[model samples]
Structures are given as C-alpha cells and as structure tokens.
Target: MNPRRQVTEHLLRTYKSALIGFAGVFVVGVVIADIVAARVADPAPGIWMYVAIAFRYWVGIIAVIFISNNLRQFVAVGVTRRDFMAGATAVGVLASVAFAVFVPLGHGIEYAIHGGSGFSAATGFREFAATLVSCLASFVAGSAACAGIYRFGAWGGLALVIPALLPAAAATIFLTTDSDGQIAADHLSFPLALVVCLVATAAVAVLSHWELKDVTIRRSALG
Candidate 1:
C-alpha cells in the first residue's frame, strides 16, 4: 500500500469507534435539546449551533489524543513522518467536511419539525459554506495544537495554544456573532470572515507541517 494511504486508513480505523460514539452522543443531545426547546417559551438556539460547539471541542480532544498516543506507533511501523502528517491532514479535512454537511442537515430536519419557530438553523447556501469553512478551521486548529505539543513539550504547547485557537475563534465569531461579538438577528456577510478563517486554517496547516516534518518521535513512557 502507498504509505500515505496506509497511514490514512490506519487513522480512520483507529478512530472510527470513537468518532461514531461521539456522533451518537451528539445526535442524542440535539434530540433532547429540541424536545426541551419545544416546551419552552423562549426562542430555542439552533441545533447547528450546538453541533458547532461540540464538533470543535471533539476535534480538539481527538487531535490531542492522536498526537500524544499514536504518532510514534506509525513511525515505528515504517511510516514516514511526511506520510503520517499527510494522512492526518486528510483525516481532519474529511471529518470537517462530514460535520459541515451533517450539521446543516440536522438543522433542516429540526426546522421542518418545529416549523422554523424556535431554532436558528442555517439552511442557505452561504450559511452552509460558512459552516463548512468553520468546521475545517476548528479541525485544523486542533491538529496544529497537537503537533505543537508533540514537537515542543508542555511549555511550548502552552505557548502554541493561542495560535491554534485563532482559527476556531474566528470561525465561532463568524458563525455566531457580528464582527464586534454581539449576537445579530442574521449572520454577518461571509467575505471578510471567510477570508480570515481560511487564512487561519492555512496558518495552522503550515505550523503543524513545520512541527511534524523531520521531527523525532518521543519515546513512550511504557517503553
């Protein structure tokens, strides 16, 4: 098998159960939230909103786990660092795309059920595009943070968190609020926000690649 393809398949296989578990939990949470919102007087927050938050956090957690625990194994098994990084990047991008598509679909279902009364779902093309970029940004940020930690240890990891957070923050601001952080009745225009998010994602990818390429794998404590 091609090294990059092998690494990608390894990642997908290793993470499959965890990702499925997370998705199940997310769906249950959204359903419960929808039920509660139906009985409430206030306008319910959107399902997609909850999805965005959960997805961002989940990606971060998974990235940290992967980098902390699995990279060395891949290297030991003859995977080149470049191949591993490429595969990991592919995993992140694919996961981001899946979330981007599914979240809006979930929102659409909720909207139909609730008659568009309570939740603020993103059902439009522009909104979907924004959501897609935001998901990608969050995944990249998480991957970058993990790479930083793997490359630089605790102190360096702490230092790198801010840069890793930029893309996720930009995505959140773009998706949920005006440029000034105030909640708006409608989503802000996508041009500037998208540009910022794309830039942040690019920055994260560059940083992660720089950290991972040609780096030595740490010895596992159990060794």
Candidate 2:
C-alpha cells in the first residue's frame, strides 16, 4: 500500500469508534428534537437545523484536537510529516463531505416525520455545495490551530488561532441564516462565500504544512 494511504487508514481506524459514536448520537438527538418539535403548536423553521449545524462545528473542533494529540504517535511510528499531513488532509476532507451529505439527509428525514413544517433542509445544489465547503473550511481551520499548538505551544497557538478560525467563521456566517429567518447569502452572494471558503481551506492547508514540516515531536511524559 502507498505510505500515505497507510497513514490515512491508520488515522481513520484510530478515530473510527469516536466517529461512529458521534453519528449515533447525532441521529438519536435529531430524532428526539423532531419529536419534541412535532408536539409544539408553532414550531419554527428548520427545527432540527441547529442540531445539524452544531454537529459540524463539534466535529471540526474535535478533529483538530484528535490530530494534535496523535501527531507524536504517528511520528514515532516513522510516518513522515508530509505523509501524515497528506493522510490527515484526505481524512478531513472525506469526513467533511460525509457530514455534508449526512446533515441534509438527517434534516430530510426529520422533515418527513414533521410533515415538512420547516424550510427545506437544503433547498438547492448551491446550498449543498456551500455546506460542503463550509464544513471543509472549518475542519482545515481546526487542523491549522492544532498544528500551531503542537509546533509553538499555548500562547503561540492562541496567536495563530485567530487567522485559522477566520475562514470557518466567515463561511459559517455567509452560509447560514439567523434564527429570525434572515438569509446571510442575501448580503454576501453564494458564489463569493464559496470562493472565500475555498481560499480559507487552501490557506489553512498551507499554514498546517509550514507548522508541521519541521516540527519535533515531544516525548509524552507518560511514555
């Protein structure tokens, strides 16, 4: 097998249990939320929408923490930084895509149960693309923050997190509307938001590579 593929597989395997657990929880949570919303006399649009959005952000933050904590183990196992980064990036992108699909699917399921009481889960292909790009950008931003912490410790990590988070924040703001039903894309066009998301993803990847390329793995105290 290719070294990068091996690394990616290993990383995926390491997180398999957690990912599965998250999926199970998300599904159950959405179902419960829908049930509660159904009982309400005046349920708002997209009753389960917040649940879906929260999951994406949760996954993003968790992805970074997982990568940061595991980098040393990968290095100890003789995986080159470049290969590890490649594998990690692949995993992040794939995971983002999976969630992008799953979130809307979950919403659709909820919509069916609720008799389509809310705004369409994902109205069009443009919305779906935006969701995917937003999720990907968020993950990349998180990875960049993790890389910063691993490379430069806490204070340095704090300094780096701002730029790293901007892309994800921008994507989120532009792609989503407030609870009041004001569409963000109305202010900033969908195409422009998509462009920003892509740029942010690229920038974070570059930043992560720069941080990890010459990094020294610290020996764990417990080891």
Candidate 3:
C-alpha cells in the first residue's frame, strides 16, 4: 500500500469508532440542551452555535495524538519520516475539511430540527470558511507542539509551546465566528484575516515537518 494512503487510512480507521460516538453524543447532547434551554431561557440561544467551538479543539487533539503516538509505530514498520509526514498531512487536510463541513451542517441540522429561521447562505459560507481554516490551523499547531515534545524533553518542549500555539491563536483571533454564525475580524478585513490564518497554518505545518523529519523514535513497542 502507498505510504500516504496507509497513514491516512490507518488514522481514519483508528478514529472511526470514536468519531461515530462523538457524532452520536453531539447530536443527542445538543438536542437535549436546546430543549432545556428553550424551557428555561427566554429567546433561547442556538445550542449548536456555542457547541461547535469544540470541533477545532477536537481536530487539534487528533493531530497531537497522531504525532505523539503513531509516528514511531509507522516509522518502525518501514515508512520513511518524510512519508509519514506526508501521510499525516493528508490525514490532517481531510479531517480539517470534514469537520469544516460537519460543523456548519450540524448547525443547520440542529436549527432545522428545532424552530428557527435558518442562517443565510452567506452566513453558512462564512462559517464553513472560518471552520476550515481554523481546523487546519489547529491540526498543524497540535502536530507542531507534539513534535517539539517528541524531539525534545519536557523542559525543552516548553520552549516551543508559544510558537506552536501561534497558528491556532491566529485563526481563533482573526477568523472568529460571531453570534450570527458569520466570520468576523475586529480590525482586519475578511480577506486579510483569511490570509493570516492560511499563512499561520502553512508556517506551523512547515515547522512540524522540520521538527518531525529526523525525530528519534522514543519507543519500540507497537502495543
């Protein structure tokens, strides 16, 4: 099997069950929260609106685990470090795009199930774009952070914490979502914010690759 496909498929398979459970829990939890909110709060807020914030962090966690745990295993099995990075990048991109769509789609589904005027196509587009960039940034940042720790010890890794956070921080600050589900920037124009987010993601991705390419595999047990 191709290394890229092998990594992609392995990561996807590893998360398949967890992803389904998360979806199930998210759907059920949001519905219950909406019901409870509708009864208690006057003009209940959209449950999915706030709940969707977890999606980016979730992507980040996946990236962290991918770098921290799977890198050694894949390399031991004969995958080159460059190939592992390539495969992991492919997985990150797919996951970023998946949750980008899932976030907005889930929000729409939540609104449709309850009673509310749906968000506009423009609002949805903003949400989609913001989520895509944010998730991508999160993924790269997570990998970079973990790669630092993997390459260096605990104290050494601390030095990289702030730099690793830059991508996700830039995304969160620049392409943030508003209450109305639109992406908003406090000072920067929409185009500029998008550019900043993409640049940050790309930079961190490069940093992650640099840190990981020749990283020592700390453990030998595949278990």
Task: For each candidate, give its TM-score against the true structure.
Answer: 0.84, 0.87, 0.93
Against the true structure, candidate 2 has what lDDT?
Answer: 0.71
- Please give the RMSD to the true structure for each candidate, in Å: 3.8, 2.8, 2.4
Ranking by lDDT: 3, 2, 1
Index of the highest-lDDT prediction: 3
Q: Of 1 and 3, which scores higher on lDDT?
A: 3
Better structure of 1 and 2 per lDDT = 2
- Which residue pairs show backbone clashes in model 2? none
Ranking by TM-score: 3, 2, 1
lDDT of 3 by residue, 21-69 (tens): 9978987898899899889876666888677877888889988888778
Model 2: ten consecutive residues of lowest lDDT? 177-186
For model 2, what is the alpha-carbon lDDT of residue 65?
60
lDDT of 2 by residue, 66-143 (tens): 566666877788888888778777877777777777766665666666664443634534445766887777887888
User: For model 1, how does the per-residue alpha-carbon lDDT over 1-223 read when each residue is reduced to its tens digit?
Assistant: 7988887788889898889887888888878877787678445545545454466556666666667777898889988888877787678777777776765566667666765333343334444566678777877787778777777786877799789878888787775532221233334566777887899889887887787787768895112
